[model samples]
Target: MLQIGLDAGGTSTRATVVTTDGECVGYARSSGGNPISSGKIGASSAILDAIESALTRANATLSDVSVIVAAMAGGSADDSRDWLIEPLADRDFTGTVAWESDLLATYFSGTFSSFGYAIVSGTGAAVIRVEDGQIARTSDGLGWLLGDAGSGFWIGHNVALAVMSDIDGRGPSTALTPRLLEALGISTEGARVQGRSPALPRLITALYDMRPVQLAQFAPLAFSEPEDAVSRGILESAGSLLAHSVEAVHTENGPLVIGGSVLAQTGRLAETFAARLAAQGIEPAIVRVADGAVGSAVLALREAGVDITASVFRRVTDSVARMR
Candidate 1:
């Protein structure tokens, strides 16, 4: 028998087919499948596409699978199950289906342990404490507008503000000013020669024309200049805020699984976040997961009555790594 695991995110969706012994046999990827970000129809379509492709590659039919575990970015929402039911029904898959938060899957990706902490810092930021393979508590997963203080969006939004402040002579000048202007397709030399008057309006207009989440495009600029005090400050602040979110859910010793672009990049933000944790004498085993689909597969194995011993976990990780 086999089980299917799906990790559905705002940027992409991945499906993995694994045997009862926890060995990955097939894998497939598709576009974004977060219903909140990609809409119900689109998200469902992406998930179904990945699953069907994976099954094809495995040379198996849906009937060969005993269970499916779906770890979705917005799976906790009231109507999230709606996104899964239609797709499964469309394929006439009647096997057991389980829904879980992507956060939990991320934690499992880093370790086989059932208890740990998980922090995600991509376009959004969130922290979770897992107990017995379930989320015990959560902090700061709010969307861009309200919270997500140390998210990519937050850092980029701050970058834009700093640039505007610099142009208005209200903040110190930084290298990001020219880089941000260039990124927006505004002529850097023209902005400098024409003065702040002409540049401010254009910058504002260009920024306003974008979707709020699109501000994440500017996040990389914060790391473009290592010596810029403004950029350094932004990263420091981001790290501090993310650390606080972790602290809010901190408990006894357990692995700390960190993922997403901002923290997994081996840059200033990740460094500062680690430093802050060290400052508080809160040190735990830290693990990094670039993809959470493997974790979802682990969950599927568990649901299918497989004992996830360390050896089993190793087999699963090794097999999935080979597929990647």
Candidate 2:
């Protein structure tokens, strides 16, 4: 029998099917707008559609699946689980169905065990600490208004504020000023801020579209001479935030895995993160999960009672390598 896993995020939904032996057979993606936000029926339909597409690609049907596990950000919330259950029920998924936050799934699936911490930085941010198979603590994942300190939204928002301040002669000059202008083709702050600035949207889009390539280019902007102050501050500050979260876990042994596009895109962030983690005596073993979709697949296997071993993880990782 096959097992299925779904990693659902705010922006995207991904599903993967894997055999009991841990070989991935198929995968699929769809937009992840919340059902509550998009109307319950619409949200449910999008999720079901993604599941069906992935199952189809695997040359398998829902009845062929022995177990299903989904890791969704904020899925522990009752309302979120409610929105998901009826959809899975509609599909006749009578086998075990497990729903939990993506953070735990990413940690367990990546580490192949049920302990460790995960820090996720994306459009938003949160740090989850799991100990002995239970959630121990979670920092507020409040959106941009209060939290999300070390996230893509935080970085983009700060970049915009810095540019605006520089344009108004209220802040120190930096390379991002020129780079942002060049990338956006904006000649003046007034043109950008007043003209319904296409520059802002383009910058945000670059975060998701150009991704690591574009972020790599911006890393140098963080240091002075050989450094750019604005970029340096962003990396340092974000690293500090991550360290703060890690400290919350207070565990000495870890396979601590970092998630989200921010770490993948910005080497400076990773370097800064390493330094910060070292200061706290936490030497993390980093493994990039690519999209965390495969990790989702592994969780399905675990739920299906398929015994996981080193060889099993290697098989899944090998399958991912082939896909890349």
Best by lDDT: 1
lDDT of 1 by residue, 59-82 (tens): 998889899998987555556476
Please report, in order, the local distance difference test score of every candidate based on alpha carbons: 0.89, 0.68
**Please, what are the lDDT tens digits per residue for candidate 2 over residues 1-324?**
988778777667777788899988877788873553455666677778877987888888888888877777654344546666777777787777777567766665566755677777766678777676456777656666688776776676666567656655678876777766675565444355554554555555545565432343433334322267777787778777767767776665666766776666656666777788888788867666545676777678877877778789888767755543
**TM-score of each candidate structure, all chains considered together:** 0.95, 0.80
lDDT score of residue 243 within candidate 2: 71
For every model shown, the clashing-pair count is: 0, 7
Which pairs, if any, clash in model 1?
none
Q: Which regions of candidate 1 deviate over 4 angstroms?
A: 188-196
lDDT score, residue 229, model 1?
Answer: 95
lDDT of 2: 0.68
